[model samples]
Target: MILTLTPNPSVDRTIAVATLTRGVVQRATDSRMDPGGKGINVSRALAVNGTDTVAVLPVGGPQGQVMEDLLRAIALPVETVRISQAIRANVGIVEPDGTTTKVNEQGPRMSADEVAALLAAVDRAAAQGLEWLIGCGSLPPGLDGSFYADLVRRGHAVGAKVAIDSSGAPMAAAVAAGPDLIKPNDEELEELVGRRLATLGDVVEACRTLIAGGVGCVVVSLGGKGAVLVTADQVAHARATITDPLSTVGAGDSLLAGYLHALTHGADPATALRTGVAFGSAAVCLPGTEVPTPADVAKIDVEVVDPVDLDLPL
Candidate 1:
């Protein structure tokens, strides 16, 4: 089973409007809410395709209750650690033209005891034979960037492959622990490498730097242009044919879910790249933060090529 840890979870409320005008009243055409946080979203997406997964997070206050209710309705297995502060709520405004504007909260703070309890839960889950242990999203207020790094170490000790999708110092710390996989978009990778990757060569070079530093694999998401997967042995580029895009929220999480699912199921890296891109593209066509189903995966036309041109355009 795949296990995900989201230290800071949220209730994501999405509202649809014809147009978003500043300093004026607007009527909502429709609205929906879902469980938020990168790891949580990954688990939700995995459940969409009948993958066995569980989410571990801290829940508190009224909003946390709402989050639990939503997860229950979707039949997601979750392990919770109680916290004192109320979990945050995020708002998203989506226009008919597929424009999305978001307002996010910093989320609740976790005390030392609370953080330790959460890690212990991960340890217990890993002991139960978890194939993948994913540490995602940002570190909450009181926790240092070393939180994800600790997760990488703990997961590795239990023989569980660790995959991380986070930014800033937390990501840097996790990289130092040599995670099995990392999923970073172009912007996040650029920040990590401290360079301007204006070409595919530059991007691949940066990913290779990570591989050399002991990271087992690096997957770079290039938004609508598709994604590239890099390992010590091979490199592959994959793009999918998608039409009528909707909201782009949770697309990256879907990509990671698909990639990890394929890897755990014994698919080759190239095939995993194709499945990851297809899942991401299918996610972009759905409204709000919804993930793709099996039908969406079958409908995707994916193109994957190995030994990509080093000097190709970005």
Candidate 2:
């Protein structure tokens, strides 16, 4: 089973319109509300695909109730830690041209006792035959970046492979803890390394440096340019077949879910990359933070290419 810890989860509401004019009223074209935050999205996608998984998070107040209700409606298993402060409800406005404007609320502030309870919940979840523990998304106020670092250590102590998807100081600290895997988009990758990764080789070298520092593996997502995977033994590239996209939210989380699902089932490096990118590509064709199901992933054509051009422009 895969376990996920979303320290700050949300209820995402996405509205669609013909165009977004700054000072003018607009009529809606469509709308949706889904469970948000990176780790929660991954668990949602995994549950849809019949993968055994559970999401552990902090929830409180009415907004938190709504978030929990949404997850239950989708049958995503959750182990919620009750917090004193309410979580957030984030909004997104999507245009017909796939332009997205998002406003995210600063989620709840947890007390010291609440933080300890949250970690204890994750520890309990990890004890239940969990294979991977994914710690993701931005840290809420009052929690230091070391939160993820501590979580990684706990997961490792339980023999679970920890994969982190976060940014800034939180990401830096987690990487230093030597996570089993990390999925950093181009911007996050550049930010973590403090350099301009203008080429595929530059990205590869950056990931290699992390591996040398004890990180097990790194996956650098290049948006439309596809994704690259770097390990101590191999560096490979995989690109997805493009499609008319509706929204880009939750695509990266879907990629991580697919890759982990395949990996735990013994798929090779290239095959895992293919599945990961396929799921991500499929997610872009859906609305809101919708995750791609197996059918959606099956329709996407992606394969990790050999003789990966190290100098490929990102």
Residue pairs with clashing backbones, model 1: none
- List model 2 lDDT by residue over 93-135, tens digit each: 9987677899999899999999999988987877788889999
Question: Cα lDDT of all candidates, in order?
Answer: 0.89, 0.90
Tell me the alpha-carbon RMSD of every candidate. 1.2, 1.1
The model with the greatest TM-score is 2
Model 2 local distance difference test score: 0.90
Expressed as tens digits, the lDDT of each residue in 1-314 for candidate 1 is 99999998889998999999999999999999999999999998898888889999999999989999999999898888898999989998998766899998999988899998998888777777888999999888989889888889988888888999999999999999999999999999999888899977799899999999989999999987799988998889998756677788889999999998787788998889888898988888888888889898778888876568777777
Runs in model 2 lying further than 4 Å from the true structure: none
Instruction: Look at candidate 2 and give me any clashing residue pairs.
Output: none
